[model samples]
Target: MTVMRRTGWFTKSIAAAGLLLMAGQASAALWSITYPRPLSENDLRSEYPVALLTLALEKTGVKYSLLPSDRILLQGKALRQLKENREVNVVWSMTDAQREKDLLPIRIPIAKGLIGWRVFLTTKDQLKYFKAVSSTDQLMKMTPVQGEEWPDTKILQANGFNVYTVPEYPQAFSILQSGRARLFPRSVIEVLNELESDDLPADIVLEPKLALHYPTAMYFFVNKGNATLARLIETGLERALEDGSFDALFRSTYQETLDKLDLENRTVFELDNPSLPPATPVNTPDYWLRPTRQE
Candidate 1:
């Protein structure tokens, strides 16, 4: 009888332990993250927010899954669906005012800054016409791309410039090159990259002028209902930044790309040096790790 009672007690204890283990496993949340584009050989993977989130997961022991989208539009649509169904957990690098109301942001920023300024590019002979146009207002008098949400287009239209919106950035450039349009405004870095790839003729010069400055911030957005996961990611990112792990990971992945792009010599917004900043001594909470959500 004594032996039977001992055996029964042991069996009950084992069953209770098994039940607890199952509960823990069931409570482990699974997240689906959407990226702005598919992974490509030339894609800037190191700068990708999804990769950073993966690193954060490793540090935090969070379970997650990824679903890559081909474009920003698809990502927005998928994220919206997920939000409506309460099925999606995270979306990366989204910027809009409406998204802020529904999503919680991870404190670390994904994009460097809001791109401002537009350089007018054209063949050398035509540069004289734009020499006096120092600002968007002055340049608005010319016929440009219409219906596009380009940085300077709306401002130019408001100021009485005939604006045309092309379907794509490359199309706009092509139009300028083919003499269909007289000017094209683009970010300096983007234009430089394009010029490096295509090797434009000596006549093509990018005019230096401030066009428009817009406010934008990129972040890892989590559904507001998944507050626990959001908080965990935020804390994990903070810890990673504090321990120098995040910078090390970024450098290991991106240093070669930076050198290739000639951006190695250029300073990142936060660091004085071109190299990645040490994650430790990151004293400013709002400086690097502040969460910002946009609609």
Candidate 2:
């Protein structure tokens, strides 16, 4: 599906105008939040978080509107909203020590650890190239492309993999398609849908038998000063979990994708996330999606 794109300057102007208009409306909601746009052309994963968050908020009986935010320059730029106290109230990302300290995190794995499983995007011809490989050592020999500011790029480099870093999201796929990089790793929930939605050239295909595993989770982050919003999210998410709505939504939204991926038949290479925060609830079984192993 096509996602309408607006430049950051225009987006901020719209947001300012929207707030002004919202203030004058008698029926205006109690809460307003913004979401990031698709990272790739015609992709719609950007709206996935919106749906989950909306359901959670609805459970709290609080009226809210999820708007599209300005394009972000850095993944952590949203965290700066807390310090600068901007209007961008809620954002989500992989957790890190500095991020947890800077923003209020709900501490639940919103995607059920789906962000940690990676499926690589590569050219069709490279299917044979990958088939010839047998181990992480061989895969590491192939260059991977990632966003310049993404923490995953740093994690890959730290693990001794050669990575091509670009400053923007679209450039990573372009670089991979142009053969400058052999692979672009994306989450399991992301890769298949992106390929389907992007209308990408026929040359691009998902590497069928490889999956990368790491320790990470996407958490809903709120500004540190916005304690009310934080409590609303925490309470709402807890209710969803206790009522099994979270798991039901998870299966409904992603079970088909996981089934299509046939994860059990793939080679699961576990990678070390040295960047994972110490405060992460690694031992909390109820807080994560542990489909592959015993907790």
The TM-score leader among the candidates is 2
Candidate 2 — which residues are off by over 4 angstroms? Answer: 1-29, 39-41, 70-83, 293-295
Name the weakest run of 10 consecutive residues (lDDT summed) in model 1: 267-276
Question: RMSD of each candidate?
Answer: 13.0, 10.3
Cα miss at 162, model 1 (Å)? 6.9
Segments of candidate 1 deviating more than 4 angstroms = 1-32, 39-47, 70-89, 114-133, 139-212, 247-295
Each model's lDDT comes to 0.50, 0.76
lDDT of each residue in 17-40, candidate 1, tens digit only: 754564365347675555545334
lDDT accuracy of residue 282 in candidate 1: 32
State the lDDT of candidate 2 residue by residue for 121-211, as single tens digits: 9987666788877788998999999987676887898899989999766677789777889999999878877888746676788999888
Q: What is the TM-score of each candidate against the true structure?
A: 0.52, 0.83
- TM-score for model 1? 0.52
